[model samples]
Target chain A: MKCYYHPDREAVAVCSVCGKPLCAECAQEYKGKVYCKECLAKVKEEEEVAASKSNVSKGDASKSGASEGVVPKSAVSEHTETSSTESKAKKEVPYKGASTAKVVFTSIVVALVIIGLILLSTMGISGVLTPLSLVTSKSSSVESVTAIPYEGERSITVSLDANNCMLNVKELENAIDDKVVKENTEGAKLAVLTSVNTASRMSYKNGTLTVKATGLKKNAVVNLYLTIRIKEVSLESDVKNASFSISLPDIPISAKLSLTNGGISLSNCTVDRINGTIMNGSVTIKNSGVTGIYLKGMNSQISFSDNKFLGNVSLNLLNGTLDVKGNKHIASFYEKGVNSVINCDFSKTEPPMSATFKNITTEVTINVGKQPAVISAPYADVKADSYFTVNGSNYTTPNYSKQYSCLDISVLPAGETAIPLGSITLLGGD
Target chain B: MSDIDARYMLGSILLSLGIVYILSNVTANFSPFWGFIGIFLIFEGSYYTVKYVFRQHKDITNPLVTLFLGIAVLIFTFHIVIPTFTMLVAGFSIAVGAALLLSGFVFKISRKEVLSGLILIGFGFLIATPAVFNISEKFYRYLHIYGVGALLILLGLVLMIPRNKKSVKKDEGGKSDEVH
Candidate 1:
């Protein structure tokens, strides 16, 4: 069987004290005694506590003897046994206590080591563990220093397979420049920056821009910077590991931006159909306008703020946050995911603001401008304002789904929204 | 090596670090297959510590401390125990370094101990440096699989040489294994 401590390794022996299986690397021996690391630590702690207690008792015994002018029988006997056995043990095991200075010095070393490790651990956790933590900081940052001139191109598609890239779609430039600034780490021998169209397999036709920056070697951190004109852009990125900061201009066109293993920061754009696919990154759309929205991804956050959607909205998230706020208009909303959350707060929405949701072990909350005309959920534990009816009966608080098989909630004058067994809350209207 | 406490502590540290480093390299696609060999060296180091260096001593505090440290490193490295393993490691290292610096003043100061403590503090700072600042531009270019693999191989070779083979046969440090 695999070791109890290390799932990948075989167990060499069971700990003598704890009876837990241990790998060879995790086993410890103390002068012909075999034990697991945990047992050894416990034994060590007990011994220190015992030693300190003995010292205190001895001091007390000496003080009592001085005050009474007589040696305590128990103290004398114990002292004799300790001296004899300890002397014998010392010969068998030549363990000596270092000077006070040495002990202090070692302790200091150990303490420092711990402190240093803590700090480093924090850095690793923040940067490597949570790649989505950069969502808020880089929400609206459109660092577009170099923009490629577009000669009246009606539609454009750019594809990139890069280690790290920041491609921005801004206003049309006066001139087209293919020059790009490359940021590379020290051991980046295999990381190469090239135009995706010329990289053998990728192709780009007229009115298409493709750039690829790939780290040819493992653990190679490469950065590619590019700025292109905002048009009917379709971006398909298949990156091993990278981050994208893209900004589409105020133009009326359909746009599709997809990423594989990075985060996307899209800011200020108006599109007919905005289809964004984020496989292992976050989606941050700020102050943008879209008619149709389709987002699908996992292990990242999807956030929208101060946006207007004139068409349908479909979101599919596996395990992350879905936050939408300040949407003035949306035709219909359809969302489905597992271990996901949908938080929407719309101050104002056009007529027929309908939504359908399906989730498992999810949390969803919608704050609407007006109470919906129809709200129906069969298996969910809902808490809504008392202005509706459940299966033709007056809606009541502190109610369970078991009592009534059918349920329906309606506001005086609004739309209808339906949700499933997930934990969903609807709140709005005075 | 004959000092059991020292051996146990050193062995635990090396083993934990070796496993973590190898895993990181493998996941990052840096070392791949070659990383396994480094783990063997770490295992060998642990074996040496338990077999020859460790002994029943007057107190077991330091060795126990070391074991706990090993476990802590594993937690921070894998991030299994918590989210954001890297950040946890950074914070822990800084706290440990500061504690060590203060501990030096608690007891009689030994130059060797002081130096070791300082080095540990410095190493902790180094680990935390990348996230806190941007000093990695020059270092990333030279930090590929080959360099890490080579270093692991060197360490493994060194460990296999058996620093105190003669001392292992003898129970005491003063004994010589030479035959007249």
Candidate 2:
């Protein structure tokens, strides 16, 4: 028989209540019998009304019984006496199925919404990160690079002048040319200072090495490959629009590194005297130690960790970020910057350390170690979130002001230094 | 008003506004949902209006007219090939209309009352003519809104009233054929 709802489709079952032929999609089963959508809806409505009426009567009966201090059988009987002929007929033919059309339609809508969301997210991500691939492509090209093994320990002065190329320095028993790229762009030739591909030059003169590369076009890109190793070496570079990544072994060295429009990365080297400068790029110094260090930068970031400064460290930056962590010890740490942020964690410092950090229009945070010291920040708000002692009074929550600008705080009883012009936040106790 | 009346009134208003918003946002899309809500409002409104208004007075022309017109509008709006708005409205209008007509006969009403019911059925059939004859889209659209809106308002008014317990019991008694 054809379905009552869909005449084109065959009827899978007949609604027991309404006696209508129903297709599989429209058929609903309840109590072991098939029913159509309309019959199911009717049965549900009737059941709900009956149930609600019964509940109301039951509640009324209970309330009356409680007030009269006796059990009321009227409400109970009202529910039990619902054995009408019509209700009996409805109960007798209780086998029916629920409708599925609503379910199918809802599922289709939800699926479409999910698909649209996924497409939108993918398109948004690709649109934002489209041009980031040019900076990382072809950045490692080297030519005329030779390696000479070291015979004995000797002092070396390494000067690398890469005008538009990366400079890398490492420590080994031999010196090898760490040239990055050898590219030949159309209608542009490099002024090769040394006999090398692409006008890039490098020559060792009287224990002083100078490397230079020039001539660049707008659309022309060149990958500079510089992987050289010199033990006890001094590396210098005055580069414009070039980045550097230097990694050397633990050796005593004097180095002055300078760059104009690129970032610098230095790791795993111990220096006697090291000074560096950068413009418009970040500086990353990690896992290294120095006796006396002086560094300056403009529009760049400076991050360092896991090293010790035996003598003193002075760093100046303009519009930059300074992140330092895991220092062994420093005799004195001084920093000056403008429109920048200094985020430092000195929770692992040895005793008797003095630090001074000053900035303008900047936000600074210094997490101090377990040493007694005086913290002073005049023009900024200072709140002691942890327990500390100031002027012989111990406090867990203390406020500092002009009358009480100087604060002596420490987890341990040892006062040796002071810091000024930065918000100092102690680690943990909070 | 009682809390239950206030709740029901608020619910009706919110649901009506929600339905109208959904319809206005995308009239063509989600037609099934729209139709379902429209039929529900029609039936619920018709039932409450008829039950309460007729309970107070057995012979009231307003409720009878509303009942007849609501059913007729449902028949016209729905009546598709599937068990969509078409079947739902058809079954509801036919069942409710037949019940009222039979009740009228059982009560042995006046000639005017009988004629009123017959006229209601005739109007219902007439309303269905647009769909049957594939009339102008503009006429069909106008009929759809007026039909659904009228029923919804009538039902909303019904739900807004606080249901009296004794009145409900009288309705149940009337349904069991306790009175002619």
Candidate 3:
């Protein structure tokens, strides 16, 4: 039988040596160790023989007095083992090949199962385990909710624990994410563990998650863990005209929480609602999509993972890290003090916007997307090639990474503002 | 070498972008990378339209082709024409979106119509933003190009990638068995 570890009930313990599985009775204790009975007996015999032979030297064993020297009591008795003694000796050393064979096999099987589980978890299982602590309503109410496809809309959770969890909503859908919802949109309480003895509930309905508590102890902190389906799976149609919109509801947090999604968008124009005004929260959005978009979350690090834009677009970065992977522009906006990271990895896409990252403090990396990237003045520390190239105008920034082609100081326009765009860059890949 | 769940993976991206593109226009949530991503998809669609459908690689409607317009405008007018172009583009996008959406409704009347109809109608309805915005080009052209156009381009991109192309493949992160 295999061993299973549990503190409360009777557990079949595994042997430290030979690693044989043993039940409470069949297992034996040796040197404060646990092992199956057969191994224990054999070990005991070896221990006794070694102890008795310890005193005798190898050289002395060949001498005369060594004959009667270390005869074990059982061995001595077994000399005249005409019948009974012989039988007893054989019984004491019961063969253990069968037991050892079983053990090795079991260990291999157990180890394989463990490894498989770990791999499954590592390969995008965060979307599964991240939702384990969700508090679903005892009654189903809202039925029609859309999420990334093959993943049915998850039932609403009234509450969730943020302490320790491994529930990912995405994975669970592919692996045992089964919960139901009612057709009618009913507000459900989402529970969060406040203190050691207190519990708080966050209400959710109509795609919104809100605090249910009446009052807070001023700066008291509470986390609302969510295994939210940030986006729904969409199937492509040959029709090529299928379109829909996803709106992210306003979520306020006490501290800050990270937001990551593959492809998703919101109906609201301002993402600041997500970064709670009074709650001191920063909202971050990372997604892959094709539609035009407008996102503004206060004090959030916003990034575009991998996206395809079909028409025009406007990108406004208020106060956050804006990273663009592949894009064609309709237009773009920026403010100083915020950082911009651009990665142009388009297979073949172009944007129709006058993409500009102005009033930036940190940095902007441009993997240019067909159209020239414009960084207007008042953007204190722009960084690129020797010459910032926008409409062939020579521009420069304070910090520039001295690598890559097609960037020089001569690209900046002459007599613009105070600092020459040329003074900001390292010419000739310097 | 040969890896990836080519199907569901692309589908996931397409759909995710679909949502992102759709929302970025209306929502205030800001994600810099996602904006570029939406732009990327829009170009991808433009490329597809030019190379595969219309064979007009440098046409005005093509996203890549429009980059030329953006560049020309930015050079001459200091980012003026590009902004207005995007605003106008948004209007045209709405019309195309409307045509797609109208097809969806039109196809509904016929029992044996293919998905082409629904896609058209959906596109139109989804593109109804210009009507939703109820604003003039003056507003849409200058300030709202990136925000509004980003969203529309994203929407168009999401619609471009075939939804049915999602593929599922085995994991390929590589594995090492340890004897615990």
TM-score of every candidate: 0.32, 0.31, 0.23
Model 3: per-residue Cα lDDT at residue B167: 47
lDDT of 2 by residue, A1-430 (tens): 8887677899888889756778899999977878776677667657755865866665776767745444357745645554453365456544233212232233234333432343244235321111111111122334322232332222222222332222232121123322422222222222322211244444343222333333322223323222322335555443444555555545455656555555556677677776766667676767777788788766688887877654587887767888878887767777765556777776666656666664333456676644454554442222344322223323233353423212232322253433322235422121
lDDT of 3 by residue, A122-158 (tens): 2242222232222222222223234422232332221
User: Worst ten-residue run, lDDT, model 1 chain A?
Assistant: A132-141
**Where is model 1 more than 4 Å wrong at Cα?**
A1-231, A252-261, A274-277, A371-373, A378-430, B1-180
For each model in turn, which proportion of the native inter-chain contacts is also found?
0.00, 0.00, 0.00
State the lDDT at B70 in candidate 3: 25
Clash tally, candidates in order: 58, 25, 139
Off by over 4 Å in 2: A1-231, A369-372, A376-430, B1-180
Worst 10 residues of 2 chain B by lDDT: B23-32
For model 2, what is the C-alpha lDDT against the true structure?
A: 0.48
Candidate 3 CAPRI classification by DockQ: incorrect
- Model 3 chain A, poorest ten-residue lDDT window? A235-244
Leading candidate by TM-score: 1
Which TM-score value belongs to model 2?
A: 0.31
Each candidate: chain B TM-score? 0.32, 0.35, 0.23
User: Candidate 1: which docking quality band?
Assistant: incorrect
